[model samples]
Target: MATKVKRARKANFSDRECVKLLDIVDANIGKLTNNNNTLRANAGKKAVWKMAAQELSAMSLVQRDEEDCRKKWRVSSLIGPTVTL
Candidate 1:
């Protein structure tokens, strides 16, 4: 019998990639807001923008988690309570 081990897949993406995606979303949003008939009529662009927003949000969450982990691993000194005369 063979045992299968589940491995966690990394969701790491380069900052450049995230920035590019955000740029695309911003452009699309601008187009949609400009009353551009072509862009307004295209449902696909809206879907793409939604997906990009989701991706950006996910990346932000990942970054926050990494920062929290790093903070957790740091050594901290405990200060004794101060007494006032």
Candidate 2:
């Protein structure tokens, strides 16, 4: 019997990659950060995130998925107040 170890993927975002992500999120700002609580707005936000992830991965050296993009956005939100966008 053999035991296998799971490997962790590298998740460091380069400065250029972060800029690309910011650009994508900026392009979809309304849908991504809207405060409206309606179902249509919620669904649109999801679609926008998916599209953002696709766009980011297409241009980025690191292939980021939808969840990855979402996580990065959430992390970036902590500095939202300071950043002028």
Best by TM-score: 2
lDDT of each: 0.45, 0.77
The lDDT leader among the candidates is 2
lDDT of 2 at 5: 91
Worst 10 residues of 2 by lDDT: 76-85
In candidate 1, what are the lDDT values of residues 19-54, reduced to their tens digit? 545355456655544555575465654565555655
Off by over 4 Å in 2: 1-4, 79-85
* Per-candidate total of colliding backbone pairs: 0, 0
TM-score of each: 0.32, 0.72
Model 2: per-residue lDDT, tens digit, 1-85? 8999999786676666677778878788888778997999989988877887787777766777778878877888776622343
Go through the candidates in order and give the C-alpha RMSD of each one to the true structure: 15.4, 3.3
Clashing pairs in 2: none
